[model samples]
Target: MSAELRLASGGAPAPETVHPLSVRGLTVAYGDAPAVFSVDADFPAGTMTAIVGPNGAGKSSFLKGALGVVKPLSGEVRAFGGPLSRARRRIAYVPQRASVDWEFPARAIDVAAMGLYARLGPFRLAGRGDLDIARAALSRVGMERLAERQIGELSGGQQQRVFIARALAQGADLYLLDEPFAGVDAATEKALVEVLKGLAAEGRMVVCVHHDLSTLQAYFDRVLMINLRKIAEGTVAETATPENLRLTYGGAAQAA
Candidate 1:
């Protein structure tokens, strides 16, 4: 599929708008320990791309780098052919369920409404339009019925869905999800996959940091094999070969 998607120029100067994400010489570190180094890649628009690697392979760090939560030691990350800060509104981030303190006092709807905070800015109350968007996002994730429920009462899968709904409410063109399927039920995983596929079909990019190699072929249109550096980035047919798997897994050949 073509990566390019048409958007109204709106009098902006004509610039080459290609991939939704472009990383060149990206390096990430944590207190003298470098996790990622000199990574270069382009994630095409309107596709589901998976970043797969073994544990401690810096997949999570890479996602954080893209979100600007973790500043890179060097290199650059661009969204929609522009700097990340300029295109921040066009990006939605779905962090791992474990990353959040679920005990925090908030309802499902309230959590989902946080997405609208970006548009509302700070020190402002959520208006009716924000509520409508929140409701719509919850409905998209099949969580509208639980809108009034406390966030602490949700199961792991439900909590993850709520976070995803929050991202949906942001109305972003690019999605970055970290370990979204981890510890979730099979039904929830299937539902999440469908939602992500729908997002990609709508000409929005969705990048997932996933671990399971068995479902790689079924879940993503493109895969990035990484271990501090990009090993490969291509379709399953091109990059998921046995040799590549050996390299990705590092001398371990488990049956997928």
Candidate 2:
């Protein structure tokens, strides 16, 4: 996609390449309390980024606000240089697993195929071709063999993989995941990391709200540290500094 245009200092029309995801002066609140403060940042394609902060730091809220899942009190967000509504097809969001109702009766393939619902529109039903696409997605996450199994019947790791497969089926250019590795097994974590890294390698944008600071270096090339407000953002080595962590995590940084 082409980037949005901006006027230069001389008022001349200058071409400016917009990042895959960009947010400016964003703030989200619940009632009178603000979860995320005015934040500004840009996420480019072909990179995996980790959004990290302490508990109650609004990492998830930041994402929700940016994606329009939760209305923000203030600010703007752009996906591929346009409003999110215009870039919906290019974006895929996998919400926090805990927020999902796993008890709902649905087969693994059924769940994966739901990703195609956007493409199918409200009037059409998923056909055999759609199921084939979903199956291919499950295979990418190494869960093709269990395609017919009930989603609730799978282990925590397997369940996570299924959702990821669902996201993959979207064929989105930018992916937003909320704590994908939170409660998965070591093997699952490794597998998830590999799958995500592969997406970035394929020139897709991958952003996740991650809690495990130890794996930051291994899993992401960039980091956006926030605590209701953005503390710092840059290459992991530059933004995940001791001082920045101290600012973002306070005493918790010492404990971690």
TM-score for every candidate vs. truth? 0.92, 0.94
Per-residue lDDT for 172-239 in model 1, tens only? 99999999999999999999999999999999999999988888889999998888888888887798
Give the Cα lDDT of each candidate.
0.89, 0.94
Listed per candidate, the RMSD to the true structure in angstroms reads 5.3, 3.7
Residues 1-256, model 2: lDDT tens digits: 2434556679877767789999999999999999999999899899999999998999999999999999999999999988889999889999988999999999999999989999999999899999999999999999999999999999989999999999999999999999999899999999999999999999999999999898899899999999999999999988898899999999587444
Best model per TM-score: 2
Output the number of the lDDT-best candidate: 2
Superposition error at 209 for model 2 (Å): 0.2
Judged by whole-model lDDT over C-alpha atoms, candidate 2 comes out at 0.94
Residue pairs that clash (backbone atoms under 3 angstroms), model 2: none
